[model samples]
Target: MEINQWLNSAWFWVGIVLFIVIIRDIFIQKSHTITHNFPVVGHIRYWLEQIGPELRQYIVANNREELPFNRQERSWIYASSKNENNLQGFGTDQDFNSPGYIFIKNAMMGYNPPVNHPSKKNPGVLPATKVIGLFHNRKRPFRPYSVINISGMSYGSLSAKAVESLNKGAQLAGCYHNTGEGSLSPYHQFGADVILNIGTAYFGVRELDGTFSMDKLKQKVDENPQLRAIELKLSQGAKPGKGGMLPASKINQEIADIRHIPMGKDAISPAFHAQFSNIPEMVDFIESMATETGLPVGVKSAIGKLEQWEELAAYMAKTGKGPDFITIDGGEGGTGAAPHAFADHVSMPFTFAFAKVYQIFQRHDLTDKIFFIASGKLGFPEKALLAFAMGADSINIAREAMMSIGCIQAQKCHTNHCPTGIATSNKWLQAGIDVTLKSERYYRYHYTLVKEIAEITHACGYEHPCQMTMDDIELSMGDNNRTMTLSKAYGYHKTAIAYEYFNELIDCPHLGGANARNRLSR
Candidate 1:
């Protein structure tokens, strides 16, 4: 009776209070929970990025003793930028007797060496013209450059500062800079040479409904005297035989304005050209564009099938409608953004496709008339030499150039947060890239690297880098499957030089000594 009476009094109220306290502890909130120590606003990532370069050298950077595109590439950039000796002070880290690496090609005892220059039957390539070459008439056609020119990289894909820097650098080097599938921004106009890429997304020069505008393209060409080449990007090497799409989240007002695209809509670039299906149609497209503007029109492809190449070649020959050059990109080539599968495994490797395409041109007797430009990881002198040796008239290097100017190649070019300011769609990040400092570095990198390529040409028993031929290259069994020279290998081949040396007359100019031949141009 006493307990029941107590339950209805102060004791019951105390019990309820205790129960409320227990419920709060278990379900409502916990005062003792752990919390991560961070700066105000949780800026750990940003702060980390602020010190990323230093931390990376100590942590994630993979070291290299003798590999190309390794620590050596970085070291070379540093040394060249400061005008210091690029060679390490220490003795060679490489194996002196290693036959696995092909270093140089040497001559046999009293071997009568013959002069081997690059192909002479090249198309007329005027550095400047009145109109965009692609829209010009083909009757008395402009000379086709070797099918390879720098592939598309728009100011939007990269920073405006970065694009202007690259275009200026390309102008200095007498090569072409592709305005990536991005719309031609105002800054890209500063360069002396520019090739506008019309991407599937049809950015920049597109209509309100997202169709291509020839009139806008012509106007762009007329406005920018640097606009000399036009490339129709049907498909890329990294994502061949596939369509292209960009998320709406990636599209901003700047991109929309440059690309002539509406905001808040998914960006789509269909895999195949809506207006072109067969080779004949592709030719007509090229011819029509050439007629529309007086500039070189070309196609950049990542070869998907052998039959397709054969058919395309046959059609071009049959209709007498040929693209000035064919830029055959390797599947392993780099890109700002693409599906992982296509970048890694979808298309033919450069070695395989390079040989096939070279053979195709030779077979059709179009080798001399149509130029071949090879792209895909060709940023270094050795890699570029390899492409030239594989029958490329010229080659383009993109990522390597990025590397020379402090890009860590985090493969985050698709992201606007690129720490180096090389590739980003954002302007604040673009401010990080100082054009003056970067452009001079670009000049140094080009001169030094091209000089190194000329050295390789000389080591291969040639006068100029352009004088190098495929027969001059030999594959090694090790590290790079390295292609090298006879002197570097120690074991020389007489059979390799037998036909050239034995068949040629000693006094002939065609059999001139390597040094007596053409000058290596700057």
Candidate 2:
């Protein structure tokens, strides 16, 4: 009677049927070679592969072993965004003996009587903000409320809801959001300051022929009251000297209309700007744009050869004018889509490039005229302090901000399958994002980061980041016994230019014979 009851059980019957079906399909299916060979057993391998990332994240890898951003770094960002307790017991998981490690030279005690104003109600302190474009050339200068700001993630690269949330967060946090190369969308109209970035393709200000249009640009600036400044993008760190890539899946009607491109097609900017091929032409282009908009204009580029930078500085010094600022991006920058070769192999990393560029500007006495904005993977207070020590007046952040808005760092940005709804254009994916809630998270993250910077500055015996110099930073030599400060390691100072090299290159009558002159003129 017991045997008959067991045989008649619903669960027993269902399990038997399921097993029979799986065995039959595994053998019958010809598509997958492994399944055809191994039958039911092969599915286990496929299932494990499907859940590999989560398994590695939760069960296999340690806190600091991941790339792009480690588990511990992401945890801090998430906690800060939620305004949750981010404190951890004991010391850090970082390996102090690791090569190229960076650490600050902390003071014995806090800055005298607290550099920031004393607060009775709220004990937390705030970092003092700085002003950009403060030189005599500009009619208006932009004083951002914080030195850390949202970097150039475009509207098409992000969803409408994401862009709206970031803009709202920028407004709430008293910072600014950069409108990336895709140009302006209506979603960017939230009450916040904006840095309108014009890439090689000249999206928002481009004419029907794909050339820059002064009328369109003037109209755009006129319409958007939140416009604070303009950035002319020469190259970015992820793919220096290459244009941006927008996959066809994200190119909706709204994005196509704003970018003035055809719908249902991949939008790729030109590798180089067509408007200017020479230094004089580039300078003229920037001056004209600044004159037209009456807004401070700047150029953004990733470092290539050091000599090219010296040449650029020499040109600006000789010409007596150039862009109001120059944004230097590190090679580790994030991108929506790029060739793996360019993203990994091209451009100088931020630390080396920032130090070199800062020295060049100082050598030519152009530091006062052109502000330096450092970007690329500087999301936390320690990294931000390192940037200030390296001579960056302000900094930009992208991936960390995305993390605050629910991005899981799945690294599916190039694919349209961003599970968190931050990078995809699919309405179904975008539905997961709640703009109001995410905006608050964004504000809180920025607020917390800024407060931490203030606290670190006080601990470093400086009233502000500007007061802290290369003397305050120490780079580990990896031997665990030796370290060096920024001032000594840089070893760069003003010196007379090599007149012979310049005279032969620039003012030579033959310019190394007529053939060379003709080749250069063309």
Q: For residues 80-156, what per-residue lDDT tens digits would candidate 1 score against the true structure?
A: 64457887666766553454342444434322224432222211111111112222244323321222234677665
Clashes of each: 31, 0
Question: Over the stretch 399-463, how does candidate 2's per-residue lDDT look in tens digits?
Answer: 88999888888878877778988887878999999999999999888878877876788789865
What's the lDDT of the predicted structure labeled candidate 1?
A: 0.61
Candidate No. with top TM-score:
2
| Highest lDDT scorer | 2
